[model samples]
Target: MDEFERQSEERGWATAKTLAEALPYIQIYDRETVVIKYGGHAMGETAVAKQFAADVVLLKLMGVNPVVVHGGGPQISAMLDKAGVKSNFVDGLRVTDRDTMAVAEMVLSGAVNKEIAHWISVAGKEADVRGIGLSGKDAGLLTVEKTTRTKRDPDSLIEHEVDLGFVGEPTKVDPKLIAGLIASETDDWVPVIAPIGVADDGQTYNVNADTVAGAVAGSLHAKRMLLLTDVKGVMDRNGDIIRQMTLSEAQALIDDGTASGGMIPKLQTAMAAVRAGVEAVVILDGRRPHAMLVELFTEYGAGTLVKA
Candidate 1:
């Protein structure tokens, strides 16, 4: 590059860095929360996962409350396989029968939760990273009931009942106790939560982690909701990512089934956060190293941005 272009680029970065330095003072004590749904490629990839943890710690240091909620579908599946447990998925929901639920709890609460906590502490950040490993049974954090799925139109050929055995949805969310852990921290505390909800009859139910993240964020009235996944956020029909979109536009995309399959529920949960008064929602790829830092602190971020 020519000297002029090089100097221009340097100057631009210098200005941004200066602004970033000034950001804390401008944003201090601004009662805002951010819920991060960390999963998929991000959780599976080692470098990305640790970097994501570092980013969360940084956010807390910056006075931005980031509640970390994660899923361990891949890890759970692996453990179940190792234990010689047959795996099954009905309509994209895990058939969380008794044995499956036990493994899910162990992996999600025990393995995934603690790993995140350890990484956060080792990443040159001060975080009292607490692995608050829980299922829906404890604290009554979520109330879930059985789901009976059916077609959008009964007369349609594609319509049929999909029985997702023992899988639960986040029908209710209680953030009081969860918030206390963060707020009561004498030092920095990165609360790593596992997605499991409770049933009305005091039974435990396995819920989608994405649903858990959204409910937590909304319950906290977070400023932003960050969803880390495999794709580069919401894309157009032409395979181009839309940098920014409003809630209405995002809802339109979902209603039209442009974001179907597993993505459908994910988008719905994110939309739930925005509707509950978050400033924005970001759906981005977690494959890139330090993707969280780039997304949170710099321009040219990694994925689609959904706004309030």
Candidate 2:
């Protein structure tokens, strides 16, 4: 055979071997629910977004129920800029007022949510699977309460409450809509959720996407909650990724200051999901292609896994 043919043969063999190795891991997650918090570079970059959609479709075809909870921080900011709305952030959460909340809802639920579903539907066409876009407002999927944070005054050395108007925390998550779609036998459906929530007082609130994902995973008793962020994973003091840690170890990281900034919230969300009965939560770098598949189906795995 020619050199080209020989190379092709070798590639085909490698593909077969990889599939063979994935069998057991695939079986482990068959018919199981995995909640993926989709954002960061993966959602921003078009090529990565397409790849992500295809991967979600593959997971569904393999009998893994993948529920995607996506964030649109950058998109919302861009839209706000266009609309001449200035934003303020307090403690990393947007101080969303009435106008800000309207723009947020438009960007997250109206645009970003449908775009993700569109990509997934495009990818799943051949398999007869489709992506259904949803928000917390739809069918009462999520009911939230206003979120408040305390900020320390530099001069007074005291803390004061900061009101993040229209920002919410998930008080109740009703996963029935999601459960029904995934449990349907005749159709394969992947639910793509936007993080906009409604409050008991008939107000709309913008929630943190990671928080929503954790809440959804907990409600569904998901087999895994995959947090796709820009970072590789939770790093130790030595700057190495900690592959696995128990709940106490994770909490210690936060308590001892090993985890800081955005990582702190991610770890806290992971721990909360674990306490809520999620089997495990993995914080993986979404910029790396196929990170979810690697985490789910490979022995080495692709991120820091947190378990109860």
Which numbered prediction scores highest in lDDT against the true structure?
A: 2
lDDT of 1 at 234: 83
Point out where model 1 deviates above 4 Å: 1-31, 124-136, 151-160, 255-257, 299-301
Q: List the RMSD of every prediction in angstroms.
A: 4.3, 0.8
In candidate 2, stretches whose alpha carbon ends up further than 4 angstroms from where it belongs are: none
TM-score for candidate 2, please give it. 0.98
Q: Give the C-alpha miss distance for residue 20 in model 1, angstroms.
A: 4.3
Model 2: colliding residue pairs: none
lDDT of 2 by residue, 56-151 (tens): 999999989999999999999989999898999997899999999999999999989999999999999999889999999999999999998998
